[model samples]
Target: MTEHDQQTDGPGQSFESVWDAIEDTPAEAANMRMRSELMIALKARIEARGWTQAEAARVMGVTQPRVSDLVRGKIALFGLDALVGMASAAGLHLEVRVSEAA
Candidate 1:
């Protein structure tokens, strides 16, 4: 790999998620993890129901372009609240859990 593409951490340093490795703080990483999980869930639900982008958007109460961004895994285009709202609109019940950090 090129020098600019190299990891800065010491050899063998590991993270629970890529977000943890790249985000500026633990809170940011946690937020990204939640957002990513929600996106994946929404995408899977759409696929499972055999819904087109327009159909998914209609069900989620969003525009087709928004659904396109979602299914394309455009994490940077969404936030936690937005994802939660979309999931709810799509009839997905969500639960949050907290645990002590390892």
Candidate 2:
């Protein structure tokens, strides 16, 4: 593919991420990206501890089905607040950094 193709879905289109391509706005894309990152971290943490969904749910103070949704990456089913709370309950420390966009 050419540089243009790499930058766009078609002529005169551009996106920085898959979320950007699919989401209606830059803010939505950013939200999805952050949620995805958090979900991935949580899933990895659970796996690294060899925890089943039930075990993870207990540790995170959520239901086993909720843990299943998390591990399955059901991003639409979770909001940032919920994910952050779960992360906190799992003993994970989180920091947010912001800088001007390029």
Candidate 3:
């Protein structure tokens, strides 16, 4: 298959969300998805500032190991509230948007 075809799912092969295609329950998948997004946002902020994990820890008020976990995408090791707190400490704004499922 060509690269274009490989990149695009055909017909019913497409998944609405990564969670929908995984083995997790709907709620667990939702939590995982949210954590993943938060991790990406936090990591992006850290990288955008050219900060090391130690610097991120200092800014986010967490230890270096914790910052390492966040940077490494250790979703299971973090909760939504904790990530939100870290994001807040990093001077990032959190916004929740709700819309009907497609």
Please list the Cα RMSD from the true structure of every candidate, rounded to 1 decimal place: 5.1, 3.8, 4.4
RMSD over all Cα atoms, model 3: 4.4
Model 3 agreement with the true structure over 1-102: per-residue lDDT tens digits: 421132324675755466555635767867777788889999999999999999999999999999999898888899999999999999998998888765
List where candidate 1 sits over 4 angstroms from the true fold.
1-9
Clashing pairs in 1: none
Per-candidate TM-score against the hidden true structure: 0.88, 0.88, 0.79
Instruction: Give Cα-based local distance difference scores for all models.
Output: 0.89, 0.89, 0.83
Off by over 4 Å in 2: 1-7
* Better candidate number, 2 or 3, judged by lDDT: 2
Error of 1 at 94 (Å): 0.6
Tens digit per residue, CA lDDT, model 2, 1-102: 521133467889877677778888889988998899899999999999999999999999999999999998899999999999999999889999999985
Question: On residues 8-94, what C-alpha lDDT tens digit does candidate 1 reach at each position?
Answer: 467888666677778999999899889989999999999999999999999999999999999999999999999999999988999
**Colliding pairs, model 2:** none
Q: After TM-score superposition, what is the CA distance of residue 36 in candidate 1 from its true location, in Å?
A: 0.3
Model with the higher TM-score, candidate 2 or 3: 2
